[model samples]
Target chain A: MLLEINDIHVHYGKIAALKGISLEVDEGEIVTLIGANGAGKTTTLKTISGLRPLSAGRITFDGKDISRLAGHKRVLAGIGQSPEGRGIFPGMSVADNLHMGAYARKGDLSKELAEVYELFPRLAERKGQAGGTMSGGEQQMLAIGRALMAKPKVLLLDEPSMGLAPMLVQQIFSIIEKINERGTTVLLVEQNAQQALQIAHRAYVIETGRIVKSAAAVDLLDDPEVRAAYLGGDLGEPESIAADEPAATADGPAKD
Target chain B: MKTNESTRERTNGSPTVTNGRPSFAALTPRARDLAGRLPAALRAPGLPLAFPFAVLGLVADLFRDWWGRQTGYVRWAIYGLLIVGALLLPSEQVGGFMSPYSDWAQLLFFPIGGYILLAIGLNVVVGQAGLLDLGYVAFFAIGGYTMAVFGTKFGWSFWEILVLGVLLSALSGVILGAPTLRLRGDYLAIVTLGFGEIIRIAARNTDYIGGPNGISGIPHPPTLSEWTVPESEPFTTLGLAGIAPLKYGALDGRPYYYLMLAAIVVTIIFVKRLESSRVGRAWASIREDEDAAELMGVPTFKFKLAAFAIGAAIGGAAGVIYGSQATSIIPRNYEFIISATILAAVVLGGSGNLPGVMLGAFLVAWIPERIRGLQEYRILVFGGVLVLLMIFRPEGLLPSRRRKAELAEGTGGMGSLGAEVGGPTTHAAAEVGK
Candidate 1:
């Protein structure tokens, strides 16, 4: 396995955000975690990234225990997260943001920069523009491109298609599929189940912080349970979230 | 909770009620007549534009912008000219044009220079790293005490003491930052405030470091002894004829001022470079969003501590200069008010910006002296000006584009996003942005 998250439990004060969730992503595979709001998909990714400490269980990357490591160390260990809502440094220009992504590493960024620009040509054109000024789709591209700059063996993508238009959603998924094809393992937390499953090799259905079902992506796509619950019966007309509903992301609840 | 909510509502609603009621309706005939008798110029359109300070500030800004935009040799030439101008500003003629302020202007340089360094140091902490270090004076205290104790008790040279003081101050900064950095925002502020008080009280009570009387006899920087000017006619003719016999004594304040100027120049260059480096980016990322920064592989804590340490070191350097120049020190000198004033300079000048903070330091240091005649109203007017600045330009007088954008408009793209979702994890994230 490129990454293994074993029965990890996470807490938000008295509330259990994730309850013994276990999942794995093998080399070059795309694994999707599908769930509704407050369902712990984001928490699972965060726990894997070491942003959230696990109450129980452990995560190992390439046979090394990584559960105790700090967030940036995990990035160095080849776990990069394009956090939900595209966490681009708004004050920094596009090139600087990309440079920051490569901050932990050293040596020539030209190769990586060129590769990222090739992946998203739009970004190359706006290299000098600040991150905050970009459109939702472009910012998402920057987020993904930034994560790729880490050259991670396993990429953790949390809601990459969240606020983008339907057309942009398709384009982003295609890029994710392309990224997976490029030999980097991917652990994807997404609300758009149909698209995520289409690109993923394996799918895990989580509900209220526990895995309800796990199977091949094709099997889960055809699975009636996931369709009724998260996919909302129709996979044709793209669904839109409650604007800020996804705000329930795994960042944990606001501390009072 | 219900009562508190109602109280909040009442406070918010009073402004609305007043807004709906016309001021003229509440004004009695006598009050209205008095208002009508006020000067006609006050009621004229574009009144703010015509205001003296506003006009002066506009002109100053224009000149500053022109100077700031010069490139390469031109920029260096301008800076060289300014340095020469500042160096040659004789104490004899200082502020003579403004008769009332003349007597105090010469005394202003030392404090103004000290405050500039402090403001720069604090800027790294509060502006770059976005950590509100209310206890910054602790570092200054550490620097001052080190200079005093080392110079007197140990019989160390001033230069040697300065190095030791700066290192010790940096260590103190790391000590303060390491454990309490997890505390964010107001919680962090309170802890630092307590830390400042603790340092003051500890210094007062500790006999080893010298009790309340504090260490004194801090020596001035060593002078060039037994120097003789060579018979170089060409060297003397370069407008340095008066400066031929070199002397580094601190008695005149000129040598000390030049040292302060050198320190400022080196610090400004070092800070500006650091601001654009990888660590600088990390500081900004941490400032923008700590959680997101961490997730993106930026070691937020390490970078924050680095900024704190650098800031502390700079503050300590300022103290060394201050202590050496004054030739005396007391523990009470490093009080809470000092930290607050330095922070005010950083804020008013513009946080995260070097030039702005320098300007702020100058204003904070120079303005008090200029208004010394109005001592009774100085603090009140000073506080009023700060409040007005906060209300009108919270980003500051000369805001960094990044800071201005963040304060004037809401955060872009991410908006209500805490990044992971639902913004709950955003609790500390919100604090990072500030």
Candidate 2:
């Protein structure tokens, strides 16, 4: 296993956000955690990134425990996250935002920068433009490209397709597929179960702070339960999560 | 490769394409055609008019690099000229015209130079790091008290006390920030405000450092031996010719003014260096989005603390200089008004830009003195001017390019003096996600 989360537990005061969640990603595989609103999907990613402290259990990357490591040190240990909400620096130029991604590394980043621009040519065209001014699809590309700039062994993507249009969604998923093809293992947390399952090798279904189901992506895609609960049934339209959960998806129900 | 083709295909209708290249849509049709005809290198991304300016900037950058490389002698010569110009500002020929009321030299040394120093330090916290510090004068107070106590009670040299004051202020900064930095935006400001008041109250209540009366008769910086310069014709001429008196005395504030100038120079050098290094980049990231910066591998908390400590150290340094010059200090001397005044300087001058803050400090210090006879109406006029400045030029007198863009977009809500507003973070995703 290249990355392993062993029975990690996270709590937001009295509420348990991630209760004994365990998963693993082998080298060069796209492993996804798929769930509905308020289903601990974002929480698992946050724990791994060290943004939220885990109450119990450990995260090991390449046979080394990184549970105690700081978030930035976790990046140094080759865990890069393109966070939810496309966290591009608003005041910074597109080029500067990409540069910030590789801040921890020393020396020249010309090659890395060129590769990112190549992966997302839209970013190259908008190099002088501030990150905040870009369109949604472009901002998503910038976020993903920025994560790649870190040159991580594993990339953690949180809702890369969340706010994009259907056409842009396809483009982002295809890019993610290409990224994994280039030998970076991916741990994806996504609400779009249908698309996430299509690209992932394996998938884990999370609900209310626990891993409810885990299986090969192809098998889970065919699973009737997942199809009904998360995939929005045979209609094939992505469910209106707001109608389903009523604000529970906004940072989960962790805040009092 | 196929993925790239599909992405290009989907986004094709968006970016205006001219001659199979992305063309600037915002440009006029004629300008757009002209831009297309220009060399590819000159045609910048979205900004067509920036092509010539970009070329000019590149040439200037190249020239600067060459100048820096060809000779340290030329660099020193330029700096020497600037230093001489600055040194001459307090002289009769310069100071007389600059201000007609009180001594311009004395004003420069204290309120002008001092406000600049404080503003620069606060800019590190409020501007770069996006941490609003309302009670920055607490650090200033700590510095002043450190100097006064050491100078009076322990009889320490000004040099020794200066170092101690800076260190203690830095320590206090860490003490305040370690617990409070977890609080963001206005919450942090409130905590810092409380900390500032706490320091003042503590000082006022304590008798050892001279409570309300404060400390007086603080010793001046020691002079070198009388024979360091001969008491002869040429030496006397040099002394009369505005060579700063080595012997710091009671009446002539010139020597003290020179000392403050030296301190400001040192502060500027250090600040300029830190503003471009890794530390500065980290601060920018934190200011933009704390959570994102942390996730991107910046130790956000540590960097914020560092900003506070460094800012406090500079504030402390300014305080020590102020203490020595005044020869006495009291709790009243270090008040919330001082903090607010320095903040006004930073905001008026342009927060993130170093030269902007200095200019702001100068204006803030000099404006009242310029209208010296109308002292009673100073507050009203000052308020009116600041209000006017805000309405006419919200990004400040010399905003950094980043700040200008942010204000232009009106995304950060920083253009207004809304007390609780945080720096701009991308709300597009949130809005769409919702």
Clashes of each: 10, 1
Off by over 4 Å in 2: A234-256, B1-81, B93-98, B224-244, B406-434
Q: CA lDDT of B280 in candidate 2?
A: 90
Which structure among the candidates has the greatest TM-score? Answer: 1
Each prediction's RMSD to truth? 9.7, 8.7
Interface RMSD, candidate 1?
9.2
Backbone clashes in model 2, listed as residue pairs? A72-B297
Itemize residue pairs with steric clashes in candidate 1: A247-B421, A247-B422, A248-B422, A249-B421, A249-B422, A251-B425, A252-B424, A252-B425, A253-B424, A254-B424
The residue-by-residue lDDT of candidate 1 on B228-326, one tens digit each, is 335466434432223412355545555566677778888988999999888888888887667668877888889888988999999999888788877
Per-residue lDDT over B388-414 for candidate 2, one digit per residue giving the tens place of the 0 to 100 score: 566434566766657655553343434
Full-model lDDT for every candidate: 0.74, 0.79
On a 0 to 1 DockQ scale, where is model 2?
Answer: 0.36
Could you give the CAPRI-style class of model 2?
acceptable
Listed in order, the DockQ scores are 0.24, 0.36
